[model samples]
Target: MERWPALELASTIRHDGDGGVTDDLATVQGTTRWIRAQSDLPAGHAPAGDIAADEELRTEIVALRRAVRALFARAVSPAPPSPADARRLMPADQALAHLNAVAAREPVAPQMDWPLDGAPVTRLLSAEDDPKVRFLAALARAAVEFLSGPQRTRLRACTAPRCVRYFVQSHGRQEWCKPSCGNRARAARHYRRQRTAADGGPAPGGPS
Candidate 1:
C-alpha cells in the first residue's frame, strides 16, 4: 500500500474546477509534496510515517522530485544572464539546458546564435528512468504558456494597498480580490493616511 500523504496529494492534483486561489494553492502544495515523494511512489516503498516504511525508496524519491522541480523552475522561471532567456523566450519548451549544450558541441551549427546562449548553464543532471521528470518537465512548459501567453497579461498583483499576492483574472477584466486587497486599495487617500499613521509608518515594506 502507498502512504496516505502521497495519495492525498494525488487527489489534490486531480481535482477539477475553475482553479481559484484555493484550488491553485491546493494544487501547488500537492504538486510540491508529490515531487518530494517520487522515490517512494515509484516502488512499493514509502516512508514509515509514510505508511510504507521504505527508507531507501523515500530517499531516492526525494532526489527525483528535487531534480524535476529544478528543471521545472529553471524552465518556467530560470535566472537571468541565463541561456534560456538568451534564446527567444517564446516557443517555450525547446530550450532545455542539456539539449542546448549537446547542440553546441556539434560542428555543423548555424550562425545566428543557434540558440543564443553566450554562457549557458552547463551542468546537466537528470535520470533517464524517472517518469516524474518528464511529467514535471512538461508541466514547466505549460506553466510557461500560462505565464507568457495571453494569460500572462491577465496576471495582476493585488492592487490592494497592503496585499502582495497575485491573482489570475477571469473575464480579463478583474483586478485584486473583491474582499480584501480590492477594498483595501479602493479606500480613499485620507483613509490611507490615517491607516498609515495608526500603523506607524507605511506598513513595513512601504507603498510600492
Candidate 2:
C-alpha cells in the first residue's frame, strides 16, 4: 500500500497562529471519499457504500484527524495552543488514545505472488469495506513505517507563514511545500525588511 496518501491524510487541518485552516474532509462521508481516492482499492470495489452519514462516524473522523495531527507534532514543531476562547481541537491524551485504537486494528497483509518472470514479490491486499476501520489501520501502520524509515528525515513542516502543511523534501534546497509558498515567504521577508527600513532602523536579519 502507498504510504504517502495515508501520511497526507494527517494534513486534513492546517494549524495557524490563532486558528487552523481545515481541509474538506470534515465529515464522515468526505473522509471516506478521501480514503477511497487515496487508497489502493480493489477493482470494482465501491468505497462510497462503506461510508455512512452519521454523527458517530463524524466524531471518529475528527478524532482520527486530531490523532494524526498530534503524531505529526512529534515529528515537527507544532503551532502554539489556541487561545482560551478558541476550542482546543486535539488534546494530546485523546489523540493518543484514538491513535492507539486505530493502530490496534488489523493491518493489511502481504500476499505471496510471482510475476511472469518467476521473480518473487509480495502484494499488499485489503478486502475490508469499512472505510473508517480500514483507513485507520492503514494510516496507523503507514505512520509507523514512515517514522522509522529513512525518509522521515526528509519529512518537513512547511515554514511559510500561516501555511500549515507537511511535505517530503524532494531536493536539498527545498524548504517550503511548493513554489508558491516559497514565493510568499520571500515576499513576506522583503516586506518586513522594507518596513524596518521605513522605521529608520536596520532591516531585520541584516547587517547591523
Candidate 3:
C-alpha cells in the first residue's frame, strides 16, 4: 500500500477532512454527505429525504468519486513508474490532485431515494468499456504520469506576474495565467472608453 495518493484524495474531499473520517477508505462518508446535500431539493429531498427526486446526479457523483479514488490508489502505489505507463499517461502529477479536488457531483438517475449504497464508481472504473467513464479515468490516470522532454517543456508554467496556472507555455512569449486575466490587465490601464474632440486627446489606444 501507499500514502500520498490517499492523502491527496482526502485533500480533494473537502467534506471529509473537516470532521475527520471513520473507516475512511472503506466508505465514502464525507463524499456521500456532500452529494446528498448538493443534490437534495429544498422542497422535497431535504424536507422528506426523497432520493428518487435526484437519483441521476447522485449516481454520477458517486461514480466520479470512485473513479478518482481508484486513480489515487494507482498513483501513490510503491510500484515504479514503467516506461510503457509513462508513454500512455504523460501528465503532471499535481494535476491529478487538482482534478480530484474538482470531482463534484454529476447526475445520472431520473430520481432517487434511499438509493442502494454499493461500490462507488462501477463499470467504467472497473473492467467495463463505457467510453465516457473510460475517458475520465484516463485523464485521472494521466495526472500521475511522467511525460517526454518535449511534452514537459510544452506543458510547463510561467513565472510571469499573476501567472501560476499550468499550461502549454512552449511559445516564446507566453505569460499571464489566462487570456481573460491578460485582457483585464490591459483594460485596467485605460482611463476611459472613447474621447470626443470636446473631451480631450484621442482614446489613447486604450492602454496596453
Candidate 4:
C-alpha cells in the first residue's frame, strides 16, 4: 500500500503495545529522525543529511501534525477519530485555515524535467531558502491534496483495542489498519463473547 505523508503524520501518535500512546515526534532527536525517514517527500523539499531539528522546528512540525490529524478526523466523519488526540483536535475550520496558511508559506512553481531516455515529469520548484519552511509547506500541501482527493472517502480510524491510528481503507472489508490490528480486534471480540457467556448472558449472534 502506498503511504500518504498526511496519514503518516497522523500515525506518529499511536498505540505502544503496553496500552500507552507513543509519539514519534516527541523530541528534537526523534523529530529529526522522523524527517530523515520521509523519503517520499518531493525533491528540494527534504532537508540535507546533516540537517538537525531544533526546538522551533519540532514545535512547528508538531503543530502542523495537529492540524493534519484534525482534518483526518473530519475526513472520516461519523466514524470515530483516532482515540489518541480525538479529545484535543483543533476545530475543523481552524485546521483547514492552518493547513492553507502553512502551505502558502513557501511559494512554488512547476518545473518540467525530461531525461533523454525517460518520460517527462513536472516537479515543484521552491525558492524558499529555509528548509523548515519548505518542509512544513510540503507537509501542509500533502495534507491539502490528500483531503481534497478521492482517497479521503476511504479514510477510517482503526477500531482495534488499544489502537489509535487512522488508515485509508484499501478494500470493502478492511476494518483495521493492518492484519495485526484485525487479529487484535477479533481476539477482543472473542474475549467479550466468552465473558458474556460466563456471565449467563446470551452468546453473540444468538437471540437475546
Choose the strongest candidate by lDDT.
4
The CA lDDT at 108 in model 1 is 28
Model 2, 104-160: lDDT tens per residue? 675556787877889876666676656656655666666556666777667777777
* Candidate 1 vs 2: which has more TM-score: 2
Which regions of candidate 3 fall more than 4 Å away from where they truly are? 1-127, 130-133, 144-149, 154-165, 177-180, 189-208
Candidate 2 lDDT (Cα, 0 to 1): 0.63
**C-alpha lDDT of residue 196 in model 3:** 36
**Whole-model lDDT, candidate 4?**
0.88
Instruction: Give per-model TM-scores.
Output: 0.33, 0.73, 0.26, 0.94
Ten-residue region with minimum lDDT total, candidate 2 = 77-86
Ranking by TM-score: 4, 2, 1, 3
Report lDDT (Cα) of residue 74, candidate 2.
57
- Candidate order, lDDT descending: 4, 2, 1, 3
Number of colliding residue pairs in each model? 1, 0, 12, 0
**Candidate 3 C-alpha lDDT tens digits along 39-146:** 221211122112222344344444444444433334433432222122334244444554554321112222333436764332212343343343333333333332
Cα RMSD, each candidate: 15.5, 4.9, 17.0, 1.5
lDDT of each: 0.36, 0.63, 0.35, 0.88
